[model samples]
Target: MTFTTRFAPSPTGPLHLGHAYSALLAYDMARAANGVFHLRIDDIDQSRARPEWEAQIFDDLSWLGLSWPSPVLRQSDRVPRYRDALKTLWDQGLLYPCSCSRADIRAAASAPQEGAPLHGPDGLVYPGTCRPASPPSGPMPDAVMRLDMARALARLTHPLCFHETGAGPDGTTGEIHPLDMLQTVGDVVLARRDMGASYHLSVVIDDADQAITHVIRGRDLFDATQIHVLLQRLLNQPTPAYHHHRLIRDDTGKRLAKRDDARAIATYRAEGCTQADIRMKIGL
Candidate 1:
């Protein structure tokens, strides 16, 4: 099979060292394997996504010596696709409307007898406050849609796993188990009340739609891969091989954020930093 990878970044902020490292790594891997590398703009969060930031992403990646095909995939343009995926899950009795707010979820997860709340890739684990016995008559505008993990898992006859060429956050490699996923990632949201799709839902759908074969990205998303695999299985989509690279951290050892303007690629370029300098800084 042709090796296919992607560097998907949200336009909520400018490209930082971390973003550079990931994009370059994915590009290098694709080239090494004589594969295709794609660039996807994850601008689903319309409230935070800015056109200027999106343009900067193109400039930064091009400056780093990268090129992708025309008509790049953008999440904002794929809402209808996500809706179709949600409809499939709903029809299969795998999804339900979640009416609880963040505060409501936090309180429920923290309630007594729940022990310490299980934290997953999407922040505090959902307490399943809104999972229903059956699908609703129709989509509710005000309700976030969540996957019923237990029911979804039960639908699968065989065990779920993914091939990992790179290490996880804990330095784990090889096949990953879905057991930990069940314990940690509880009832993840597929579609938000405001936004049509959540990161987990859109990412899996996008990867499948793009026919992505190898998912090379930061190790920060290693845990989230569990959720992605589950979604892929539930949707009957093909799973791709994964390579989770180490993250680039700041001098203080914290993961770089978009707000860290000092570390932004544009800022570095303005300061007379060369493309080689970026590669060396990111240890390419």
Candidate 2:
């Protein structure tokens, strides 16, 4: 199959060295395979997204010697597609409205009856406070939507798995089984109360929409791939081969964040660092 990959970044902050490593790696892989490379702006969090940041992303990627086709996809402009996908799952009895806030979920998970709180890729796993016994009578306004993990898994005829060419957080590689998704990824939010769609939902839909064949990204998302694999099965979409590469970190060994402006590509450029300097810094 023709290889395809994307470097999707949220425009909430500057592109740090970590971002540079991921974008350059994906670009290099796609070019090496003579396949397509895409730039997707995951600007779904409209409250925090800034035009200047988005512009900086283009500038930084261009300065790093990367290119993608015009009319790059932005999550904000694709709400309708996400809603349609949610409706598909809702109609199939896989989704329900969730009214629990973060605090609410935490409290519920810590309750004596609930036992120790289970953590997942997205943090403390939801405690299923709003999961319904059956589909609601009609639409639920001002409520987040969550997938019924058990219900969704039951609809699958075959075991779900995805190929992994890169290491996971625990050095896991090869085919991955989504066994922990049910317990650890419990009823993950599909659509947020504020935003129409969550990362898990939007990403799955976006990959299928773009016909992405190879998902090359950081190891941080390796565990989340189980949730993605399950969503792909529920949505009847094709699963792509995954390569979760090592993350770039600071001297303290902590993974870089967008807030690390000192490590920002723009900062490095202003200090007279070239693209080669970036590659060497990130050990590419």
Candidate 3:
């Protein structure tokens, strides 16, 4: 397969130093191997996405010396596709509608039950609030849809693994066992009521549809990879080789956010910083 990867970002705010690092790095790697690099607009949450921010994403990346294939894939235009995948999972007894409110989850997670922290990140087994004992019967519901983690894992007959060119946060490399997933990441939201598809589901579908051979992103998303791998198996999609790189942080050692306007690529450009300066700032 060709060396294919992508840099997907939401147009919710300015592209910060972290975004620069990721996009530039992906672009560089793609060029190095004579591979393909794609720019995908991760506007799954349309509520916060803006045209100005999307425009700036193009401007900032171009200023940083990067170009991508035209007619970029935008999540807003792909809800129907996401819904199709959701329906497939729903029919396979792998998805169920979720109706638990934030308050309900917080209340349950705060008070430990069944010797498992249902809502706790590290101990997240599942809340099972809206998860039916058996897959609900009917056309797919118009509510939040969550994957049944255990059921999804059960469907995977083979041992799951991914090529880890970059290390995970805890230095985890490959060969993720089923227990690890069951112990940590629980029944995650695959399709949200408002967004139509959650990050995990949309990303899995997008990567597959794009024929992405490798997934390169920050280590913060390492844990989420487990969810993706499981979904890939359930959906019969190929799991791309993953490289979870280190994050770009501010002087305070906190991961850069869009709110950090001082670290925004546009701010640096306005201050007369060159593309190399941006690369150097992000330690490319």
Candidate 4:
């Protein structure tokens, strides 16, 4: 298959230096490999997605001399598609509804007997508070949904693995360790009460649907790759090779966030910095 990849960003805020590095790196690699590079707007959280920011994404990428195919794939336009995937998992007894509030989870997870709440990609690994004792039945409720990781694992007919061109906490050639994931990644959210899908769920489906052959992101997300791999196996989609590059951090060594407006690409542009300057600033 031809090399293909994507840079998906939430339009919840301005694109910063880190965003530029990820996008430019993916676009550069795709160009070098004679592959297709896609730009996907991860605007699933409609409450925060704004038209101005969506337009700014286009403008910023263009200003950085990057381009992608027209009619960009916006997650906001694909709720039905996400729901269909959720429904399939639900029918297979691999997913269930979750009604645990943040406070409920914190209380249960912090109980003296449970030890400190274990943290995971989805944050504070779900205590399975709302998880039914058995696979849920009947129509999948239109509420928050989570993967039954243990059950999801049992459905896999073969060992799950993916090629890794990136450096993770482990070595290359990623492999899924079921027990490790069970304890750590535990029942990640698949659907949200308001957004209809969580980032993990939306990303897996989007990458597969777009036929992405390579997933390029920061090393920070290396731990989350297993979650995606498991989802790929469950959904019967191809797991792409991954390239997790180093993150762009501020002088203080903290990774750049959307709130870091000082490092915003737009701010740099206003300061009269050139694209070449950006490459140097990000150590590209």
Top-TM-score structure, candidate number:
4
Which residue window of length 10 is worst by lDDT in model 1?
134-143
| Candidate 3 per-residue C-alpha lDDT over 1-284 given as tens digits, one digit per residue, 9 for 90 to 100 | 78999999999999999999888889889999999999999998989999999999999998888888989999999999999999999999988887888777666656655454543232344567777788778898899888888888888789988888999888989678887676577788888889999998899999999999989999888878877888898889998999899999877889988899988999999999999888888888
Compared with the true structure, all predictions reach lDDT values of 0.89, 0.89, 0.87, 0.90
The TM-score, computed over Cα atoms with residue i paired to residue i, of candidate 1 is 0.96
Candidate with the greatest lDDT versus the true structure = 4
Q: Residue-wise lDDT of candidate 4 within 66-168, one digit each (tens)?
A: 9898779999999999999999899999998888898999999999988989999889998888888899899989898999988998887888778889787
Worst 10 residues of 4 by lDDT: 167-176
The C-alpha RMSD in Å for every predicted model, in order, reads 1.4, 1.3, 1.7, 1.1
lDDT of 2 by residue, 1-284 (tens): 78999999999999999999999999999999999999999999899999999999999999999999989999999988999999889888888888777899999999999899998987898887888887775664546888888888788788778888888988887554455677777888889866789999999999999999999999999988988988898888999999999999889999999988999999999999999999999888
Error of 4 at 127 (Å): 1.2
At residue 129, give the lDDT of candidate 4.
85
